[model samples]
Target: MKTLYLDAFSGASGDMFIGALLDLGVDIAQLRTELQKLPVHGYTLTADRVAKSAIYGTSFDVVLDHGEKDHGFIEHHHAHGAGDHQAHHGRHLHEIVDLITASDLSATVKRHAIAIFNDIGAAESRVHNVPLAEVHFHEVGALDSIVDIVGSCICLDLLHVDRVKCSTIADGSGFIEVAHGKMPVPVPAVAQMLSDRAIPVQQHPEVHTELLTPTGLGIIKEFVTEFGPLDAQSAVQQVGYGFGKRETGQFNALRAMILTTSQSQKQTAVGHDQVTLLETNLDDQTAEGLSFAQEQLLAAGALDVYFTPIQMKKNRPGVQLSVLVPPVDRDRFVTLMLKDTTAKGVRYTTFERTVMQRRFETVTYQGLPIRLKVATYQDIRRVTPEFEDCKVAAQKLDVSLETVMAAATALAR
Candidate 1:
């Protein structure tokens, strides 16, 4: 499966998104052909090879003569025109959805396009204090945004991309002039969208402009699954550059690339997770406190927590608290250790672990619930009875714990 990585270095815009895919090798002619499936008309979809800040990239544009706003038109930058100046009326969120759903586009393309529009509608509804069904999309509902969004989706479908990832967005800081008058750079809808989606934004102290657009953010938040820096492992097949309508001192472009599965991602398909080991030595805490810390860490999602007897400075006996936790849960687990243990310092290291796929099932043995943990690895499998369950069953049935365990084990087999 091919994976697409979106580098939101210049932030994201509908135009930039389409341009990047075009540069990544999506045929512009074919893209335009596919977009013809949409029922809406009176707009032109164009992609041209352009240079911005001395870097060449595909610049995509959707042009219309009638609309409340003309988006993707940037000044102080140079690019060739690829769209016709056409006359078209602006649309509402529901109208756009109807147009897409009514189109001959594939089911996936129509679904994704409407979903992206819905995100924008939800944010606009919240920011403007209007019902979602009644929200009027001023700029996003324009012909340009519509084509850019739907066209972008069709391009992705053509590319046959299986996964989408992006970097921490460089959301420009400052103010921008909009139909609602001068507003913050992120704008109310963009801010609300970013806040609602929980997408990470990178702040640059020098740049002051609206780098990331509301339409751009909504598209990414809907489809892009992972967010962070580059994936050092995946081998790059091709790099596509999408240009934005800005004149920042640096090259203002979105660098997207296609990648093959990395070794780690391949392992993850078989029930493995990247983990971080957090370790700290506690010399002053009482034994009971150490015991409590282990219990807390385990309950808080640590894969495993254990204590090792050790000799610290001055040959004083100490216990090393070690915790294994998934990378996503590292911070929470680390915070837990710090708050629960007497150690003033903690350290962690990341590694990969092959965890056998496992699940639990309840079985009635002697009218008591006996939990069986069934674990599998390829053709190998193991079924083990829960010790706690067996002990409870023994107490309730007036039998030895060993006898209860044997019965549960026999039933599991």
Candidate 2:
């Protein structure tokens, strides 16, 4: 198993992330070839060594050709009237999408890049009250942003990590200026992008400035799977620094760590597991209501949800609702269950389970084909239905949910 750990001690920015990856040895030539796919009239990728506090590091820069508007705009945008005027060479979200689709990159790479942009666009849209397509990306729509995004995707592809995990961002306090003008720290756009992801900004004396920008926030918002304190035992293969422009009392840099693990562990084989299983029994709820609650819990990011028939005290009938969630999400998920269910108290346990490599095969039940994911840990095979597919099949065939799930489970074996 392989993993990438992001340490946003100094915070993250679009360019800093790209520079760190480039410094980490991703092929710049290949990245440039892909960037050319965007329909920008003219542009060039430049990589060079830059110094931060006497530490020489690689800095990635984008030089774009503005054609006629180059003169006035360059003069207007530059700090002083030294260079030619520059054009608003910034691109629209649609243009970025077109560039991504037109690039001759692998399908996986393209999908990843597109998904990243979608995440950013969704955030910008939500904040501005505009449609995603109509949203004009501010800092992230620029040439540098496009390069950062495409380049980050390429770097991830090169590393070929199975999963990416992040730690709670140490987003510093204070306000920062942007295209929309100066706003509160951790700008609204960034807040919206991280609506679902957990990146708590803790107060640290050594930290200041808006360390996490919307672009960088959007990247993690879409790709990260889990968030918490870094596990000290995780094996680290390499560590790279993504530097931001802020200088706080503490060293500021986004630490990117590549993890080393066996291939089987990457998928589902678990050598050691410590997971929280939350359970509650309710006898007064209908099967349909339990089903709806389960759906909502999973959608809220619970790892798994299930129901078990049980005989309560005095032989009372009840359904035990169990939800498995990552430690970070436990509080939120538990609150959701409490609000949605009639259970007065929920019981939880931390247990260990050995996991193994398991594969699933497509099977047909009642003329509907379904795919099942089989997870094996310590020779115990746990099979589960592809519920979304089962739901679809049940609706199409006009069959009960149980009938579809049973058929799908049987075929999976």
Per-residue accuracy of model 2 over 345-380 as CA lDDT, tens digit each: 888887776546666567887777787777876657
Stretches of model 1 off by over 4 angstroms after superposition? 65-88, 262-413
TM-score of each model, in listed order: 0.61, 0.57
CA lDDT of each candidate? 0.77, 0.69
Q: Give the worst 10-residue stretch by lDDT in candidate 1.
A: 71-80
- Stretches of candidate 2 off by over 4 Å are 50-56, 66-88, 203-208, 246-250, 262-413
For residues 1-413, could you state the per-residue lDDT of candidate 1 as single tens digits?
A: 36789988889888999899989888888987897777767777768898776778998887764543454212112232555331133356778788888889999888888898888877777887766665555466667778888888888898877568899899777777775567887778888887755788876657788888878887898788788876544778999899988876667888999887522222222577687999999899998898898776764446678889999999999989999876876776777889998889899999977777776667889789998777788998877888888988998899998898778877875
Candidate 2 at residue 40, lDDT?
Answer: 57
Give the total clashing residue pairs for model 1.
Answer: 0
